[model samples]
Target: MSRIGRAGFKKQVMFVLTISSFIGALIIGGAVYFFETHQVKKNAAYLIQNTTRQAAVMLNDRLNLVFTQYNKMTDKTSLWRLVNQTYQEEDSPQKYKDILECYRDMKEIYSANSEIMDSLYFATSDGTSIPLYKDMIFEKRKINLEDMFQKNYEENYGYYWLNKHEDQVFPTRKPRYVVSLIQCFKNTKGEAAGYMVLNFKSSYIEKLLEKAQISENGYMMLLSDDGFLGGTHVEEKYRLSEKTIREILHKENENMEKEGFSIYQVPLEINGWILVSVVPVGDLVSSSRQFLVILGITILIILLIAGIFSLVSASMITRPIEKLTERVIEFQTNQNVSFPVDKNMGYEMRILAEGLSKLKERVEELLRQVKEEQEEKSKLELLIVQEQIKPHFLYNTLSSIKQLISMEENQKAEDMCEALSRFYRLGLSDGRDFITIQEEAEHVENYLLIQRYRYAANFDYSINIADDILKVKLLKLSLQPLVENAIYHGIKKKEEFGTIVISGYEENDFIYLKVFDDGIGMSEEELKELQTAVGRGKVREESNHFGLRNVNHRLKLYFGEEAKLVFESTYGMYTQVTMVLPKTKGEKEC
Candidate 1:
């Protein structure tokens, strides 16, 4: 081959390579711009759709919970439970103190209406107010002539209203505004007991609607069906200003066939509610313009890379770059990359890039498999651990009973054995998280029976469960641990035959359980410490080798914050642990 001939061949090769490089650069630049733009649009759409769905679900759940809680607060059986306590008429000072403490507790539990609550208060039929304002307690405040209840009482109607009340405790005594939600409370005998008034501060509702996440340039407005706009995040002038939300609906198509819904109907399917969500067209356009600028910047970056490749086109190298593009596409599609022929590929390039891609694929597959295996192992371990704990309790109880039997204490031993059997049976029933109220009560009854032998004549139990509550769902051992706490901490040391009452009933849509014992109880300080421990998830400690911590943890684990163990104990007298459970449908019968 002559030098000129070889040189011409080389030039021809370079020329062909340069043209290929130019085309490749153009294609790659276009691909990058297209891929990035598509990703941006996809991400934005997904974000909007997911956020809206999540917001709806979260808000609906919160609303349902609030309604359930309110129902519990108004339950007929729960109210009757409060009035049916067997306190002595010739009561000691300690008895009065106990009653006062119980009343205070009831007020606190009922007052936990969340940050969005307007106001919550309990009023007796006699116009005595049990007001719970934040941490302050006002017991038995008599209604004055100017009281809001006066008009309602005179009218002989149970109704709520938007009104104001002077803050007697405050120096200003400025009449603060409130939207009252009032209902007539009835006893178990179907007689009116009192009027329960929940006065919600308008500001609280305003904050709730404001705190929720909203789309940019979007606003939330709440209005009554009767043209009364209560609150909104719109302009200050528009806040609380009455606007006919339904009138807007009527204007949309006046002659259209009317369904059950009003024209200004809220977007959601909630009952008796008007929620309006509006976003200005201008804001959407403005935001899309900003998105376009971001897209332009991405295009510029790709164009720069194209310019670099165009300048390098005269060089006869294309295989490495092409291989890299192919690998990237393979990764984007979640497919394994095929190995290119090594005829023109450099050994270093092949090992550096392609080798790493292959390694990543192998690693991902291995991780996925390992994750599944680990989850299975964890589930198995949990079951084994639970089984192990139960047998340990059962073995000890059975052994104690056997020893009693050998000592010719047949009655006590038989009772202990029967209780132990029932307890184990309840623990093993269907292996589900929830049981009926009767089932849970029966479990507690069995536990108390076992304890009775342990502390014979030391304490007596009086259980008063409402018939309506028998079908309500409750955590398996909700009452048992509380009862155990009363016995172990309150009555075990007392010489007298103290009374421990275990009772449960349904209120609006909640199951309320109370385990009370008239024995030696702890001071307020100790109770606070216990609460703090439970709140921090550090309920278990070496000093407290008891099941109360376990009970608190399990309650939280199952029912969230709305339902957990709560208690109030008076030193040297007695302790009462109360549990609140949401009414879950379809709980197993005893």
Candidate 2:
């Protein structure tokens, strides 16, 4: 071709490339925008739906737990028998004393488990009501209870759930929202003696709903056919349209836009409940506009690629300008370019992209590694905290050892000193955290001996270690905590010295190490709170059982979830703490 022909050819190539690039950019931009918008909205819907459903399930579970606890307290057949055995008529002085004792025991049980109960009343067939509260029965309750039970009442009607009563059995207290579960109990022959009515305040349901909600703006509402049983997260002056809530539950999965707000709803069918979450739509979609800039950059990069490809494949004619183009084409073909860059900016961006690509793999690996490393650190921290008091005791034991040496009883002195030395040795054994059950029993024996000497045998201790379980491994300092708590918290406050029994045995797949103290034991309420905290893996700030909790955590960490600490206590009687450990560590080894 001539010079003029080649020049026209170059102009035509540039024109076609410019038009095609513009059209292709528009197409690519539209695709990105559409794809991003669709995915983002879809993800938003999924997140809200999942969150709402979880909130609903949590509501159902929490309510069920509350009711189940109350049911167990009032409906146990054994409890009814005890009640009858306590309240029998025409009894002698000894029998009446037994009745009073049984009544006190029932009062304690009622107080310990009644976190939500407003009143628990026992109405006799003779129209007499015994309301257990403040350690005294309110006699006036029978005035209202006269209507509750008919004379010579027989056969149990099971339980009746009374809603919205607001009836206060006690007249002195302020009135509140009240619901009662009324149940009639019968003797073994199926003759009803009386009724037990359990009353609950609205605050109980409020607490339940509050615990169930997982989101800040989210609220849970208990709906029945009657509408609005109870709920939480209700804002003052903010009207909730029942129709809108029903519509949301029925028709919408994404945003249900109302005036200035959008609602998402999930229904829990178990208890006729609905969980509603509301957010301003602007808040949901405001950040999503960032995708527009990303789409624009993506189209610009695509256009650059197409333009470079066309330039590389253009004619190989030898004009002055064509020679320059031929050189550009040759460079493009011979070298591997990171991007279709005509200038310095794209080349700089390509370097940045490569750096990010290199970091991406390391960042992902670090994320997975960090969680496990952090967990290990937490376990070590627990160990360090539990081992805090060792040095002071060691110093004291050494002082005692010196005193024993001065007494001219070299055998006794040597034995005490050896025990002291071995205590620390077993504690810091090769810097390991676990030891055999036999070693743990020895450690506690040493502690008891030291204590026995210090207090002049003010408290006696008995250690019974089963030979079969002696080979089982446990965390260091596990047994000492329970013994120390028994001594200081139980025996220390008692008028007379008490006996502490440390016993260990293997049962099925687990090892049970129990510390029992026959001293001024904890109340039923104290036991209940402690057991609740242990079950939830929460330690109370005011609790004196830090060592026990620490040991409990380590056991759970090393011995699977089957490992835990259990407590049983009776006021003015005794307290027993059992540390349950799995026989093997399973996947988590020492």
TM-score of predicted structure 1: 0.36
Tens digits of lDDT, candidate 2, 322-439? 4334544664465422223233223333344455445545565897889876776676575565574467776777777777678776776677776766666666667667777888
Report how far residue 564 has shifted in candidate 1, in Å.
2.3
Task: Estimate the overall C-alpha local distance difference test score of candidate 1.
Answer: 0.58
